[model samples]
Target: MGQHEKVATSLADAVGEEIGASLAPVDAELERLYPGDPGTRQPVHTVYVPGDAFAADTVRSWGDRALDALDAHAPDAASFAAVLGLADDLAEPVYARVRAKLEREPVEDLRVDFEDGYGPRPDDEEDQAAARAARLLAEASARGTAPPYSGIRMKCMEAPVRARGIRTLDVFLTGLLASGGLPDGLVLTLPKVTYAEQVTAMARLLEAFERTHGLRPGRLGFEIQIETSQAILAADGTATVARMIQAAEGRATGLHYGTFDYSACLGVSAAHQASDHPAADHAKAVMQVAAAGTGVRVCDGSTNVLPVGPAAQVHAAWRLHYGLTRRALARAYYQGWDMHPGHLPTRYAAVFAFYREGFAQASARLARYANRAGGDVMDEPATAKALSGYLLRGLDCGALDTGEVARLTGLTRADLESFAVPRRGDLTASSG
Candidate 1:
């Protein structure tokens, strides 16, 4: 009964998914990855620290610094409390906990970026960076500091950087093997992938790495960045996300959108490189349709705005991040990139608010549909599944507790657990 009770606390119906983080394999950020309270708090934001600054000791302190910033610029938790309809005294404690979480684990997924974050470094410098990143990976593994989802991002395999990207990956993998082997849940990020051939090439490279390192053939899975126009629309004017996944030959784990780059490819001016631009919507819609049942997770990009002003002025940045995150959540893109510490509070606030606002209606409707007892309105299987997903997401993100989910959905813990293990096809099926 004790074991069951502990295990049942999980969002039993939540599916395995990936979130985005682009960090420079620097020391300050790394040490913080495994904070003091690993399970007490979870990070909603992904840190994007530059590669040049990545150091082992320094990486460890990034989380604490972010927490300090959160405390310093503690935005009026007014909006957060208002959305949940909490009183001032109660909300103050809740906000304090949120603030504590920001400091404890501000980074959920850390991407040791060698691409844009690293930029173009000298060959020897890039090689050294790869080596140091490998060392950090080893240390993180030993200390249990690696995030639940973590890895490195190499330069694009298109154009002039293809050879360099391959070399960087080779060096990094070699170093990782020598240090402590690949960590569990490590994903490689291939940025600006424009053709099926690039993905196929990466698959071949990963296979080679596995063989050379004495690992299994498919040990490494990679994510493709859908940044360019070609990645979205091929020369024949067809959707490419599914095709790229197919070319990955089962090595494709996720697809991430590069908001600014994609917009630039569409010829949108710098001023208009916004997340909600119609161009992004069209591309993401296509991505959702093409990769629906393939199990390839899709991640939205981060906002460029940083909260650098005084506490009074920081809420604007918070509001922007909150709005963007909310938009992504509404579209079912739960995971996204977080570029700054300010984004941490808003990320959780937006997610919790979204889940809390619709909880009662969604739970009632899902219960009625699941029981085959029609309620006030017609409920289709698809709607039921989406409703179930909403509740599951709430549970997964800690927005709703397992007990609350059970009460609202009338599902036992085991039933909730079963709801979380379905394949994409099963989850999205027209009939249950």
Candidate 2:
């Protein structure tokens, strides 16, 4: 038999053996779990970085700084208005330096930090903390100064836990989503994701919130933070992560890399020196590999230490170098985080640089492959292999577009149907 026939037969036989006498039911389950044809095209290379603090003061200051920097360096009206009203002080020299950087750089994504305590907390401060977070979100929304694509990290995990009870997380997220008046494309960041159950619990809560608010079911989406050791060290770590992604199903937008938390879990010192250490890199690499072809964007955690020294020259040099490193990661198909307004220009610079390079390379390679296969070729076997590669690459670069991929690859739309693998739960009914 030919290779393709042999492979298909083997797979079929394996399934039959695994299910024993229930071949039909097993086939049905397999079909549900691995539905669709083989050649789906999805965009993969979008970048998302977190904004350090989204409180009124921080956002306002950030905006002002962005505007002043833009005015001095680029002097463009759009940039000026977009970044204006950040803070009270103009800091002309700082603005001038930032403007210089913006003149040449472009930003694609911005994540605004809503709540994360830096250090130390009292047991009695839970209620106050929640109220404080609520007020901050409210002010940020009302002020209209937050970034266009902002996100919020709720107070999900804190010592002495303020938002208590069984539905505490649900209540906290609901309050933030409802009373906070979040931006339209806002992403909710879930920190310390340990188990698939956590993701499912959160998903159910989101569904309930949508129903209560009269909003569409999938209107709210979340990005999981895989920072805990339990997440990385689980016996079925990869499977668990995949299950978490599948649990979110259509509601998860991306996966975030939490370096510090992850390091702490591994008993590594949570210090600046540990930001991109070998262990962190290996952990992030595993996450990236797991997220491939899943249509879920993955981002690297932020640098914990900020630049210090002669404000203008030192910050500028530090930022420029930092941007370069971020650019490298982006080029490798991993987006990262930025914690401050001053870091915005660098974030965008990295994004645009990475995309410019990625798109050019991908477009050229795809064109070459198309030519080699001959125009409009639709070899199912060949197409499946190529499409798998394309899906992984596209997801890596955030360039997945079904229509565009179909047209370019010369694959029938039907072939793209199998891109999303169905959940194992969806395929089987448990007797218990």
Give a tens-digit lDDT track for model 2, residues 48-91.
Answer: 33223234455445546655543454364343223332222223
Off by over 4 Å in 1: 1-46, 57-62, 79-97, 369-374, 377-381, 410-414, 421-432
Model 1 lDDT-worst window of ten: 33-42
TM-score, model 2 to reference: 0.58
Q: Report the number of the highest-TM-score candidate.
A: 1
Taken over the whole model, the C-alpha lDDT of each candidate is: 0.72, 0.51
Per-residue C-alpha lDDT of model 1 across residues 48-131, encoded as one tens digit per residue: 555566667544565665556565665457655654444565466456546654554455677888988889999999989887
Candidate 2: global Cα-lDDT?
Answer: 0.51
